[model samples]
Target chain A: LQGTVTRKWDINKLLYANNIEPEDVIDRVYNRGGDESEEEDIEEEDFFKKKIYKEPSNEFDSYKPHFSDIEMLKNKWIFDNNNSNIDKEDSAGNSPFALISRRFILSKKMIGEDDS
Target chain B: MAKPSNIVFQTHRNFRIRLILSTLSGKPIKIEKIRSNDVNPGLRDYEVSFLRLLESITNGSIIEISYTGTTVNYKPGLIIGGQITHNCPITKPIGYFLEPILYLAPFSKKKFSIVFTGVTSNKQDITIDGIKWGLIPVLEKFGVRECELHTIKRGSPPNGGGEVHLKVNTLLSSPLTLHVTELPKISAVRGIAYCTKVSPSMVNRQIDSARSVLNKIGCEVNITSDAWRGKNSGNSPGFGLTLVAESKKGWRIFVEDIGGPGETPEDVGTRVAYQLFEELSISGAVCRSQLPLAVVFMVLGKEDIGRLIINNNQIDSHLVHLLRDIKKVFGTEVFFLPDDNVIDQNNENNSILTVKGSGFTNASKKIA
Candidate 1:
């Protein structure tokens, strides 16, 4: 009976009264719930894509630096196996001269380099 | 020899690849269910146009289409390549027709000296720049001589009007064997930016933007611009960039991009340059889209084994299907082995593909 007062329980107020930081509760309640990997991929992928995902408000602000091809290779067939849109954005045509040229040099012993 | 039965195919997918393989292997093909379920069904105008073009340069070739155009029966004939003119449809670019013909021309009775008129560049198809810089070099590996691609007029889509002359001499008795398992560093980079029916300034603008990114490769870059005016220019205004990077071994990789409505010249140039940069960073021996050509050539080479080391990233569904189709038509098996000898661990994800050539020669060519 002593603890029978049905008071409205506001976690924020309780945390405030106790000087407790409701960090975890705040994240769960207000965060958009995207997983960590998804967030990380979005951040890394936007700069590599040629097509502008969104309109630029200002010219200078939308400038994306050119990424090294090695860096671009990081987004290889791993993503393609899932049949993702990223592959579609860059894939060559199924028929004809797709011209998707990235052919690297193929040397064995570094010796037979005579094809010129 | 008995006339081989037709290879039955379903759907309109990969119509061009199948057509070429059938022609080269002398296998008749029956294609059915071409968009049979679609409300507006039947073979598209481009396919019909392409068939007509094939028939013109070939002897005794018979292509019969059903009344509804849903079914097609193709019996390929000897390629008597000499001089021909084809007015291609706007549904596909001029490169669409050229890609297949280039493969057939090497084994023709004479040599290929053809003119193609149609949409020169578009988003959905390969462009002329790609044919010259990308495809042609691969053909050169087969010892196809006196090869040249001259753009007489620049055209865009919709109201398309463009003319191009493609001359390929030296009908090979047999395609040369290819054994490029490794590549040297890129020695130089070159490109051409073209603008038609638009301000000539667009060409320079596009070239500058492309060079801005390509210059970082620390290699020599020579990018030129071509601006067409008046009658030579296509009906629609458009601009595009095509780049070719030559390896020390003389093998080349290509990059290209076209400016569409709402896209700025800078966008096309930068995108193409970045595409090339990205391509160079990958460890493949050929560009992604051109893998089929390289593989097909190897398959059609002399009976000796031809070897190629390809970056694993270049293998996609398209390459997978192309390999299957080649195996089906040519009866040649291609072998892929793990490439564990790469010096750098970062570039170790590759395979060595070896195809035993069928020793296919120009059967129709008369011997001296």
Candidate 2:
């Protein structure tokens, strides 16, 4: 886009300064019509009224949610719409230790047998 | 005060974005060894043409190219945008030049009204319709007003002559911070099947086939056919399709396809239809071509962080380099947080991209 014109930039893992997604929107003009589960759900406010509700999901996290299901789509929308935990471990790339800062790793003064 | 050092770069891999960021950020830059080892080295015709267009719109942009065109030293000046005309090289579609200019014109000191003549639709880049319908609304979200891109004439590609008039008024001192993180689902589908100097009947064939595919999606589909004759059709003979998906939240995704030699109108229709489906299936709020513009605007907006929703599968090697170049020029870094809201809770496919803006205001814009 010239890494070997240098594509090495491709292999370099992204540096998330505050670690939102070890990765990567809409205006929430929320409607109250689909609040069948609002009894068990909590409403959140953004620039507009928004909702956050959990959907049924497998624990290991290998599922690609189909967009055909309206309920599933709504859950995915709410869950992604929340940016509060963007830098958390769940939002990081390597599922487990996604938010481990590169700066922290670089700051670790390791000898590696000190064979300079 | 003394001058700041320039952002040094090598190769032409990411030629356009660097210039765009440099211009928007007003940072001096020096690029070296652009296609240095290629068969015919140095700046290509389109690259030079883009530089010329930049020079035309700005007051004091000093662009210096080495004898071999392998190197360029550009000290960007304030954008003094006004009515201007540019004849782009036929080597590239006008989309190449037009797309980046949209990133700039809003910050210009004067109202930007320009007439660009060249290829309008092609396989290589986003067609003019894509720009008019696709990117403009996205710009609106950023608070830019009075934007218009009109296709005065249609020119397909190779042996080309086309004219497009673009006007962006209401000098925006700075674009609004993008707060859109939840990409609204597409609610309607709209499209255009335009043909110039070809069998007008082909339009129907293209439209019907595209409709065949889109009808399955179950959105209110409307594909309009436009046939341009005589001078308005430009010099080349060609036809193409532009599809735009709109959401209630004003999210628009545009996809275009042009007919190649021996390629049927039906084929063009199906190609573009499938392309739209592919885009819809992907999770990004912005399409591949629109990604650079969206990301850059976020970095240049108010210092507060701007967030965008995108799919990991959408990040190509091109974007990888763009993110790196953005850091070098703007000193702004982007955050990538994964999304695990899927039925399988797959955290890797989707994520929110956050960038703390540089809060750039147009220095040349007169305080009215």
Candidate 3:
């Protein structure tokens, strides 16, 4: 309103624009908002929390899954074994006398134990 | 013991006869079809009659025995057929089981007849009807050469198990009498110790050493491993190293096995020795085109030795004595081989190595 047109607003002017007393706002928002307030009943909330988080009748909830049910694959044991069908085919198709003869000649090579 | 004599003769039908024989420890002589007229004029007729006849003929004196085909008189002429049975003593007829047959279909899961002659009987003929034409042989491809062709009798009774029994007689053309006084000499040597926990490399080394020692002493060496083997739990693994060599004297073979591995080395070795001789004997029994000479297993480094002697005609009785003597000489040093007792005490040192019997209570020593 002055000839210089100063822009800064005083405290009284800011308080009037908000349309509420500073004392009344502070008393409602901070002073009366503790646990003691009837609207903020934290103890009743804590009772319901305890009931929801309570343990079920079963005790081994974490131990439900079996170790074997989850598989860890291993390839050596599966692939390294001898082909039994091929062995059977060779024994049946090949000449027994020839096999015996070969065995006689290369006996050192035929030293494997008959486990399978 | 005197060597087995050879029996030979010629039939009027141009068929030749020869029997090289010895007495078996088991069965005696039994003849099926023969008559006094069939016997030669001045020949003795007890044991080894055929042998004596052949011997007399070979003695630079000609003694001939005549046999005629059983002829059937027809209006046009006479015909002769069927089998002719000759009587002679055999060591044992068991040698016949070793005959090798031509297996047509190795995977047929069925055994067929071993036909040596014409397809005259239903029991001997094998027909592969459903099989492809490529599988069966043509007329000219039959097993017999110069065989008389006969029409195939179609409706043959099913050979229950598809196996047929047959009898074949093979005559020698030039029945020469060559006395095989000495058998294929087999040197009996101690087999290597088969240890349960020993590595294969170790066994190989032992075999090599044993072989070198044996060969240095003029024993021929043949090293062969077994085909099948199981866990050597309380027993050792035994095998034989046969050394076959030729010298100025004759062909000689030496064999030894240290029995263990479920069976004793000697057990397996002796069995193999018998089998080799049996094969030769069977060849003699059938009188196939080729026959193997006798096999002798000479036990070395030990006073006691085991011998399994088989000829064309019989398994010798001296084999038992020879085996017994071998054990008595070696004493307890070698156990698993055919022995009278488990622990031989005659040799104070018990230096000769041997395998414990199958039922050995003491745990086998682990040798590498």
Candidate 4:
């Protein structure tokens, strides 16, 4: 009975209620994935791979994290929970460090839950 | 008691939240970098107008803006409530200004009678109807009675010339503690499909489309269609729909959509109804938009643990920032407990947010 109730209320029904098509959700997810990947690429090129030191103007500067830094922190939380070795070389022949750096970008494709 | 030092913050994010906290805590604050990177930046006219309104209600308040308008130093004064008239800027709807005022009105030194003239409903912010239908009851939940919000004129965006009157009486001696953990069944759905300086047929189209979407969900909706013309209508021509879903427990979920240049009336109606349906589907005490207001009141209420179940997805940056500000100003901590049931994992978007109130009491009491 629970399964029947669950099946009765499906994603298509939600989409219909919201006046959105399945294609729209697909397009939105795809576009979000693309944007995340592009942002990760930029972060990898700028912050992690090459550490450029900048002068801090305010006392609170140390407490503030960059967008890329926040992304890295979220990725680290997921990685620590998954018990994935950070130093292991991936099948793509990328070094462990390189894989860790791009972990957020690569993991983006695996998580497809709708945030709406 | 030792005087508290000033709190310094950077950036222009959540300006209203910071101002509300400062006013309630009676603490001085310095905020720098008000949209510094943007072109023609540093405190828009609307923000300055909001500050002026704040000044009108408070006594001995000190506000200093830098020459570039990139920084502000504010020292809050005693909240002295009385009759006041404010012309809100056209950039924002009257709801934006009314929200913080509602939060502060109960604790005011006297009765408050405010006349606000501006845009009543718009796409960007909450509408006046939502506040009257949704938030007023939430205020009453905290033991506040005799508060009224009435719309004298309906206004839309751009060329706004709307008017709304708000009157809130003094609050109770002790703030009532609230605990809304149980999900209540939706009792009824009410809405207003309003159009001004537009075709009367547009309102019917909106109502029909909205009914089409809501009637399918086994929820009965009673919608009132309103059409204003001539001098009563504002400068702009537009139509919008505002829907409020009331639960058996008296909590409300409010949703609104306004038609603009390209959007059709049918789209506005369907979208607003769908949004309301999505909100109703969430098993929580309050709607997503009311989360911040609830948290703020919880901090200001009598000393007791207030617990609420809210959707995890509804947590926004503004709510997070408000939580942090509460910690800094009131020394109160908020905890989030995620639902851990594996069986309900597929449908569990609800999380529990708990906080202890600071037992704040209004300084001025009415004499019998």
Ranking by lDDT: 2, 1, 4, 3
Over B286-341, each residue of candidate 3 has an lDDT whose tens digit, in order, gives 11111111111112211233222222122111222222222332221221222222
| Number of the candidate with higher DockQ, 1 or 2 | 1
Report lDDT (CA) for all predictions: 0.70, 0.71, 0.23, 0.69
Predicted candidate 2 versus true structure: per-residue lDDT over B1-368, tens digit per residue: 98899889877766777888899888999998777777788888988999999999888899999999999999999899999999999988888888888989889889999999989977767788989888898888888868999888898778678899999986887778986666566667899999989889888899998888666444578999999889888888998998988777777877787899998998888777766765665646777666777888888898898888887655543455577789888888887754653222433465678788888888879888
> Candidate 1 - CAPRI tier?
incorrect
TM-score of each: 0.76, 0.76, 0.20, 0.75
Greater-DockQ candidate between 1 and 3: 1
- Ordered by DockQ, highest first, the candidates read 1, 4, 2, 3
Kindly list the per-residue Cα lDDT of model 4 for residues B192-225, writing each as its tens digit: 9999899999999999998886664444589999
Write down the C-alpha DockQ for each prediction.
Answer: 0.03, 0.02, 0.00, 0.03
User: Ten residues in a row with the worst lDDT in model 2 chain B?
Assistant: B340-349
lDDT (tens digit, per residue) of candidate 1 on B248-279: 76677776777877989988887787777666
User: Model 1: residues >4 Å from true position, as ranges?
Assistant: A1-116, B1-3, B341-346
Q: Which RMSD does model 3 reach against the true structure? A: 40.6
